[model samples]
Target: MASPADDKESTPLLFSPKGGGHLDPANNGVSDGPRRRAAPPPQPLETHYFASKFDPPQIAKVSTNSSKYRSENLATPIVKKIYSSYSIIKDAIQPMTKPSLADEKRQGKIYYEDTYNDLPWRCSCGTHHKDGIWLNHSDKAGLVMSSLVWLMIVYAGFTVTLLVNNNSLPSHVGVIYCTLCALALASHAKTALTDPGSIPKRAIPNEDNASDPTVKFCNLCETYKPPKSHHCRICDRCISGMDHHCPWMNNCIGTANLKHFFLFLIYVWTASAYALVIFGMNYFLCNSEECIFPTGLVALVRLMTFMCVGALIFTSNMLMSVFWGIMTGMGTIDRMKKQEDKTFDESEEEPMAFTDIFGIGSYFTWFLPIDPIFNDYDSVMGYSNAERLQRERSTLV
Candidate 1:
């Protein structure tokens, strides 16, 4: 029943390979399957490329914000290497400082030799000492003797005054008083004049650093002396309450002699007062006796001279006695008191030895062991006035 045209249209076409040719599905009006992607052209070989044309893929632009990059660049090993290298180089170039022995020897010898003969005493390092202050043991002894004499003179004068004022007073009383006073004066004088040279030597340790400021160890005397003791620089021995070296006495006033000095002060004061009183009484009592030196005008002049001199001596002696007594009492009290609040230089690492400051006991026996003040001769005695001036000059140079 179907026409030829309909039949032809409904029939499917099938292409067959003829003469070794492939079939074309699109030309036969049948849709072809998915087309295959075209193959890309072959890439050029990398080895044959120019070195400058490609920049090694630009190294992928890494960011330091990453912990991995930070650790790698800033390793502890590199930091430690820098530090050690600096220390080694610095140590290699550092200069060494050392002590100077030549300077020490020179200074020590100079100070020792110059000061040896002047124990307990010091020269006025200046011109003022052409006539020095004589405060030696002998002088102290003499002062004590003078004081005793003064006591006798005062008692004698007082007795005479009492006899004149009280008619009932016995004459024998005056004689007894005068005799006792004379004995006391003579005893003091004898004690004071004792030879200091024969006294035993005692070395004094450094008092400032000692356990007891009131007591010191003496190497020469081989004993500990009472407080306020100093070795006489002149005698090369220790003295108690030794104020200073006395060129006049040429000996140290040790504890053995200190009592005499005080007694002397007492006696001197008494004698001075007695002299004044006697002078005044005699002036009135013998006014009409021609006031004779040997007689008449000569005697009057002599009497006047005696009175004037006696009055002056009395006043001066009295003042000195009072002052000395007060000072000694105060000093004694001070010695009894314990010192608190000790201070020292923070900058100093070590203190000088006792012998070094006080000197060797053998040569500078004021202390127990004659010791140099310091082995460091350059710093010995500190900066003397001369040395200070020298330093000032060197600054300009």
Candidate 2:
């Protein structure tokens, strides 16, 4: 409602800190009645403070965090080097343990063992390896000696029998039986003494990664072996399931020819019995006249030798047979006990009869070839007589 010029003059400008502005009564302007003093300017405080994003002031915490981190990073290699140095010193100070008295004794005795094959001494694997059937060169020599002695006895008896009885066996027949039997017996004995048959580490399984403690205990051989298998330091071969090495046969007898050896024992026993019977009959039939028969001295000597030899052969055979039978029985019992100790229905069953340590009979059947009739060729040679015959027949055909 007022004029535009009056309206513009009545409006007041806002006050600012830079300079005072024109005022109107409507917006805190002075009246014409009395003059008023301006309010004193706000006084500055005695002290002032400020804070920044990079630096806080109130808490004067001088931080060593950066330096601490840097120091720790630098110390890593030093700490590691110090530890390594200390470890070396500690190792140098530790004394080596001396071998035990038992170990020393075992080492000393091996030198005088007489036989090439070591007796089943206690191995480091904690197994008592008493089952030694190793045959060494000495054994082979013994076999040859035994066969010679046996032949002498047989020949002497046969010659005496021809005089006593009108009817007599052919010379060739006696020779053939003696020769064949001697060879068979020698071979069988040798086999019994050697051939560990596959795995011979002390109680070591054939499975991959198998471990046994006794394997390292062979001081004489200086190698690890499974239980029942020993290293013949002389032979330098680990025999599988080694019973023992027999020097008389010059062979290591293991699981392979155990049966043949037993058969040889039986044969010796029978042969000895036959010799005893003939010698006894001849001794009684010769009349006690003229201070002794003309041929009586020789007969008497032959009879005495036959008696002595037969007794030795018979006794040895009996003892060996008993020993082997006992071993087999004990082995079977142990296997059964193991099976029983495990779960009632565990899949692991007792191994079959004649099963070697491998839980398989393949080694004996194929490798050793035990049957004299079936295995006509030499087991060592690995060829059957049938194969030879087949070849010959093929050529002929």
Candidate 3:
């Protein structure tokens, strides 16, 4: 039996519905304190690759760090794409191999500097000329034939000239005809006798490297040759400014002898034509009595007889001379054009044909031996002389 005041005071305070911490899905707010976390379930070990970017890709165990925190993310999709692409190329490319020590040692071994540098530059001329150096040259027979051919042409021209007005033309004509014949004979003799430029006998120092653009060494002759030079089978030596072997001239057509060579053709052809015309005119213009006026009747008859026999030979020779001149002219023009174009233009794609350069412009320089001029041109003849110096300078650059 407690009094009313004590009973009221002892009763617990009742909370309002709005202010109370009630358990209702709709009305309960999130708690400020951290919620309890459950223990994670055991996860199965997954395969992975571990490689440094600097090393070759390889199969590797899952690294401790990678496995510890890796979760289901986009990395697996990216890795799958990489593997699919890489698989296509893997078979084509082999694993890189390391070089062995023995291989490296052999490659790095050294020897005497000039031991390998002395091998002769091989040439195709070896087959044509078996005789080495100056022993047993093959051009002796050609030389004799060449001399005889020249003499025959001179004799024919002289006979016609003498028979023409007792071997004397009116006024300056005789002098001119005689001068022409003499020059023709002299030119032929000089061309046949002169040595077409030969390579120096001394070995070119350090001339082993074929890739060296400035110098070309001839292994056949064991000497150095300049550009546009070749070994002659008959001459058994390296000839500079090599044009071609002419059995008729009994010598190689080369740079130094070209002046006389080209002139020889002009004189020979003109002499033959001139003789034929004079002989025919005299035969047609005069009757039998006046025809033998200069020489005795017997000598005149003999001269006429010789002319009949040799007419075919002279005609054939003149025609051959013409053909050779045309070919040589074309070749020279072609060479000049190449040099000219090479000096000015560097972007040329197709090479000009050796024959295509023969045209009206080239005809002007046909008789002139302009090799001297072109030899000095911006070095078009591939290290002949100045070109060597030019190449050397370019290497430094």
Give TM-scores for every candidate, taking all chains together and pairing residue i with residue i.
Answer: 0.30, 0.37, 0.43
- Angstrom error of the Cα, residue 123, model 1: value is 33
User: Residues 2-109, candidate 1, lDDT per residue (tens digit)?
Assistant: 664322321112222122333345555323322212332233223222323322333545588988778878888788899999988878766332224346566663
**Ten contiguous residues minimizing lDDT sum, candidate 1:** 9-18
RMSD of 1: 29.9
lDDT of candidate 1 at residue 354, scale 0 to 100: 36
- The TM-score of predicted model 3 comes to 0.43
Candidates, ranked, TM-score = 3, 2, 1
Q: Which candidate is the best by TM-score?
A: 3
Tens-place lDDT digits, model 3, residues 290-348 = 55445454474356446534644653664564354344432333345567887533243
Winner by lDDT: 3
Residue range 1-397, candidate 2, lDDT tens digits = 6564333322112212233324566644532221123343333222222222222243445456778667877799989999999999878876434354356567873111112233345323211134333434434465675556456545655554454443333355445445444654554544544343433333223222134343334555444454445565445565544445454334544454555554455445545555555445545665544223245456654665555576557548555644643445332233345558863332433332444322244564432325422221122211123333334446566
Candidate 1 lDDT: 0.40
lDDT of 3 at 274: 63
What ranges in model 3 sit over 4 Å off?
A: 1-138, 164-172, 201-217, 225-228, 287-289, 293-397
Count of backbone collisions within predicted model 1: 36
